[model samples]
Target: MPKLKIAASLLAGEFINLERDVKEIEKAGIDLIHLDVMDGHYVPEITFGRQIISTVMKLTKLPIDIHLAVTNIDHTINGFMQLHPRCIFIHPETSYMPIRLLENIAQAEVLPGIAVNPTYPIDSAKNLLEYYGGVCDVLFMSVEPGYGGQPIMHKRLQIAKNLRPFVRGSMWIDGGINPNWAIEAKKNGVDGVVSGTYVFNDVQPMKLNVDSLRGESLSWRTP
Candidate 1:
């Protein structure tokens, strides 16, 4: 099994001082930076663009993980690639040709990932995996993607559990992932988690919260 890791979601950080948040993440030694890119058509919200990604790259050396919850998959991928993300994940439902898009991402020397929605069936990923399973990472959303601060869902966790055996590469759970949720995610074969608000909440330092999420501490409580 791959070692569990945490990707701090920028969407969940302090928007006013995002640079400071990135610096704190770098200082605390979190695994990666998760960028949530949203297009209004696919997801109801709109988020970071290339400029934001560019600014973050200048702020920290941590790996950047781009989650494209957007329409026009190819265009978004091309625009974001200029920042040279470590991995780029796109929704299968949004892409006209998911397999081809995955191939293109690999060709660009970036890890290609597929993001599965909370309501999506576990079997939907099997076909995509059959074609590009070895080269791809699977990200399961524990809540709906467009918004933040939603409660974690049991059905979503079950989806991750069900897909664990078939996934060849890493499996990540996103949306409302906190320490307890992360523990369940790890048990169900999740290698990494994408956390936002819980990680950047005012109640605790980001490092400690991040550490708790990774199961480094069991006595974590909000201040």
Candidate 2:
């Protein structure tokens, strides 16, 4: 099995000093930077836009994965494509034709990803399997979309496991991932773990917490 990677979601980071926070997270050895873009219609929250993402882009060389949690998939898709992020993940619920949108994202030279919320059954995304099973670059399973620090829903993990066979690229677990759950997700065949609160809770230094989480993930011996 491949080693599990960690992506630090910036939603829980210090919003007051985002540039500083990105530097801190990069220093902490996060593999990828996860950005959540919410439009308040899909998840009842409004987050930063391309400007913030552009600012973050100037700060780090790490690959950025932008998760679009908006109701207007077409507008969001067009808006973010201009920013040239490393990867783009759009919720299937929001997109009228997710498979086709995924193709458009791929044509734009950015990795395309399909995101499914915790409440949606894994089978609900089956239409994508036939069309994009091997084509999409990533599959993000969200326990919750808008905010950070939510609890990991065990059912979501099971859903990820169920979808692993069909997912050809990488399988990412988003939402509520911390040191404790990272190991569990890894053991169950998750390719990457997306963490927000666990890395930037302000309860401890962000770097220290990330280091500890990485160590915990490394220590787990899969059976």
Candidate 3:
């Protein structure tokens, strides 16, 4: 198993104090900065556009994992590619040409990732996953997209267990990920997790907040 990587999800960060939050997360030993890019058409929320995401890219030295929670990935992908993020995660259900999009992302020298929602089981994407081969990675949403502060839905994880064989490289789990749930995620074959609210809390030391995600049983102070 690969060493667990923790990504601080900016969807849960304080937007007004983004730079400070980015610095704090990096200081906490975060491996990646997970940026959730939601287009209102796909998910109800509308996160910032290219300028904000570009600003976030400049804020941290850590890699950026941009989750494209939009209905049309093909149309807007080039915009994200221009920013040169470390990786771009797109949902198979949303793409008109998922393989082509993944190919485009890979050709752009960025890791192309496929994000599976809790409602859509990974098993169902087996053919696409298999066909894509080395072109993309996997990201399982332990909770629903669009919103934050959801708990890990164990039943959904159970539903997604069947497609573990198709993972080509890294696998990341997002949404409702905290210390305790991360343990369950690891068991389900996740190499990284996008933890937001728990990690960006105002109560604990940044390092403690990060280390706690490594499966420690510390009481989280609410932000």
TM-scores vs. true structure, each candidate: 0.94, 0.90, 0.93
Best by lDDT: 1
lDDT of 2 by residue, 106-153 (tens): 888888888877776667776676667556654555566777767778
TM-score of 3: 0.93
Off by over 4 Å in 2: 216-223
Better of 2 and 3 by TM-score: 3
Q: Candidate 1 regions off by >4 Å? A: 1-3
Model 1: which ten-residue window has the lowest total lDDT?
214-223
Best by TM-score: 1
- How many pairs of residues collide in each model? 0, 0, 0
Q: Each candidate: RMSD to true structure?
A: 1.6, 3.5, 1.8
What lDDT tens digits, residue by residue, belong to model 3 across residues 15-129? 9989988888878888988888988989999996889989988777788888899976778889998888989999888878888889999899998988888777555677888
C-alpha lDDT score of every prediction, in listed order = 0.84, 0.78, 0.81
Error in Å for residue 68 of model 3:
0.6
* lDDT: worst 10-residue window of model 3: 214-223
